[model samples]
Target chain A: MSINKDTVKYTAALGRIELSEKEIEHFTGQLDKILDYVHKLKKVDVSKLAPTSHVLEMKNVYRDDKVKPSLPVDEVMKNAPARERNLFKVGKIIE
Target chain B: MELNRLSAHELMGLLDKGDISHVDICNSIIDSIDKKDKSLNAIVNFDKGKVLERANAQKGLPVFIKDNICVKDELTTCSSNILKGFRPPYNATVIEKLLNRNAILMGKTNMDEFAFGSSTETSCYGTTKNPWDLERIPGGSSGGSAACVAADEAIWALGSDTGGSVRQPAGLCGVVGLKPTYGRVSRYGLIAFASSLDQIGTLTKDTEDAAILLKIISGHDPMDSTSVDRPVPDYAKLIKKDIKGLKLGIPKEYFIEGMDKEVKQSVLDAIKKLESLGAACENISLPHTEYAVAVYYLVATAEASSNLARFDGVQYGLRSSQAKGVIDMHKKTRGEGFGDEAKRRIILGAFALSSGYYDAYYLRALKVRTLIKKDFEDAFKKYDAIITPTSPTPAFKIGEKTEDPLTMYLCDIFTISANLAGIPGVSMPCGFTKSNLPVGLQILGKAFDEETILRIAYNYEQGTEWSKRKPGI
Candidate 1:
């Protein structure tokens, strides 16, 4: 139930959040405390139960595959920090 | 007359009679916000011209949309630094509904960063202080919305409840907040916190206003596959003015140890008042209640971690320009954009969902969630509604539970079960403490049975003096 530094770093990396030494320490403490509390769920017998991911009993909600008007390209790019023509610009991923 | 202080229902009457112009109401609100907001810190953004223009176009209540709900072309920051400059291209389905009805958008109110905390203190904009007592917090992540309604800064407001985000704040601020059935309201445009548990609800001055707003927003939406296919009822008209012979259950587990004595007394007195008004009160059991918070953290944070992953630097929010590579950009942007609580939750979620821990943590919690939902289901079979204290205590001091996140998490223990059960729930002012802080009584109903709870709440609200006491902010 304890959250160690390695777990914090690994999870931070998984979530793409770069944590500093202090935050790692802070989060390790906080997460460990939280995990310890959540660890109590182990006592409850869930052997005969099914997992409920959503309350609504729904399957794929189909819509007509027809063309529709979307935001103008300019509007689409309005909040993009970096853009080139009609595409979002990102740090170089390829040479 | 103090038009700013009137409820939406009352205000609408004046508007219908041409006794008050939309411009008049809008200017009164603008003036009130200008004068009172400096002390309350409830409103994060406001522009008179924009509000007036929207007001004049469609004559509806001046409503505040929680900062998390997108309003199309308006800044839709979930009150986070990462989304600091973001304005959504399309309105959330709820916002679009409001617009069609001519609901005036006052401005996006502040909230906990990504709806992670119970108190508004977690908001990056700064803590939104409770209007009743300036040093205490207005409960959050819908703190701004509830506080505004309590302060009469807005006639009604829309807030998204993941786990008591709307109700807890509403309870603390002496207003009314409702979390509709999980699929009763569309979540299409609401910024997600916990997808399964998330619901868009209302914060209003009274239960009637809650009924009015709830009716407008409830119904199926193609954009939100989870929205139920049931027909929306006229909740305002459906509310029974009398609760004679109505069966209300008082779950003994809700009045747990460490609950503030005054809050417990207020809830009991309210129960007595309901009984005196001819409603039958019976003690009920919800055995799985203790494990709710533990299950909630696992289920909610897991969904949150996945939902928030979309905020990676590339799409529409802040991008760390100093990074040399794409991955580095994402890491830096998220690290910088998110606040402490957000980082804590994402890491916790990522840990829970990570390999080796997924089965024991996330899956088990889901099964336990089924147990919690069943508890409510069983209770509903026997009782018309369940009642409890909305929060264990009234509004607490700003820094009261910040140092210990678990203590802060427990503030929502009583309210989280309603979300897990997918039942509709509401928190309305029941009484005030000796120190003048407000206490709330929670009324929970069966899934999609908001009408019954609204009726019970309306009858109780009509008989009580609590809802009539406005904070002299």
Candidate 2:
């Protein structure tokens, strides 16, 4: 349950955030505390219990497949902070 | 017309009586924002011209929506930089419902980016201050909506509750917040958090106002696959104050080791007040209560990781330009667009869902989630409603727990069970801590029994003066 500084940094990197050293230390302590508390779950006897994902018993409620008109592309792109050639422009993904 | 100070119910009454035009109300609200929002920064965007035009053509009541909900032609950032300038092509089902009812769109309120934080400070625009004490947080994700209602910036506002976002903040700001049963309201327009747990609810100054807004927004939405097909009940017609012979359960597990004494005492006092109103209170045990936070973090984060994957800046939201190709764009944009909290959750969720850990983490948590739901079901068989402190402590000061995620998660201990069980719960102003910060009492009802909880809250609110204790703004 102990979260070391290195692990914290790794996790932060995966989350795409750069944490300051101070934040790393603080989060380490905090995450350790939370993990300790939640560790109690290991003791519960749920051998026969079915894992419940949705509380409602119903299933497969879906909208019908149909062609629907969309707002004009110009109106949709009006709010884009960056755009080009009628497409949403962004930073190139590949190196 | 002091549009900023009127509740939605009051505004609706005025609109019905033809005392003021919807345009007048929208104009007054916009003016109020211009006058007050300098210090508050509660509203993210204001479409005054469009709002007025819409108002002039219809009823004059003003409505503030959480920034996460989609509205055509308006930015739906969810307060994250990733969606900094994204606008939806269509209105969310709720927006369509409001427009059909002729409610005027006031503006979009700020929230934690991606609805990820307990405090509104995580919002891209800035933190929404508690109206009572400006330095403290307005309990968040729904912080802006709660603050706007408390400060009377908008008549009534809508907020989404995934875990305790709406109820916790509403309690802190001293207002009425109702998180209806999971399927009671459609989530089609809501930016998804934990899809299973998220429900759109109302934040208002009074239970009756909550009732009215709920009635208008609650219904079957063909657009939201998760929305229930059940008939919308006549909520406004059933505001009863009589709690006579009603069975109330006080869970033993909620009063845990770290709970604030003042909050515990205030809740106990509220229970006594309810008893005085002819309700019988008895002790009950939801033994699985201790596992709620763990289960919530696991399930919510897992869903969040998936839901947020769409925000990689390709089709919508903020795009990072430094990368060379599509894959880089996804990573770079997500990296730059998401806040620290949102990132932490996404990473944590991804880790939980990873191949080697799925069973031990996600699957195990799901099993415990069921145990938690069973606890509520078993207890509700014996009791009509369960009462608990909405939060273990009053609203903490801004930055108090920002670096400490555990403390922030602990703040939701009392409110997470209802989300897990997919039941209706309401938080109402009950009392205040010595710091003069407000505390809330939670009334949790059986699945889909929102009316019962609201009736109890309405009755308690009428008999007590706690709701009137506004923070010294």
Top-scoring candidate (TM-score): 1
Across B1-473, the per-residue lDDT of candidate 1 in tens digits comes to: 88889998998898888998888888888888988999988888777888877877887778889999988888889989999889898999998888889888889898999999988887889989899999999999899999999998888999999899999999999999999999999999899999999999999999999999999998999889899999888999878569999999999899999999999999999999999999999998899999999999999999999999989888798888778889898999999999999999999988899999999999999999999989888888889999999999999999999989999999999999998889899999999999999998999999999999999999998888889999987
Off by over 4 Å in 2: A1-36, A62-95, B1-3
C-alpha RMSD values across all candidates: 1.1, 2.7
Docking class of 2: acceptable
Worst lDDT run of 10 residues, candidate 2 chain B, spans B323-332
RMSD of 2: 2.7
Superposed model 1: Cα runs more than 4 Å off: none
Tell me how each candidate scores on DockQ against the true complex: 0.86, 0.45
Output the lDDT of residue B29, model 2: 75
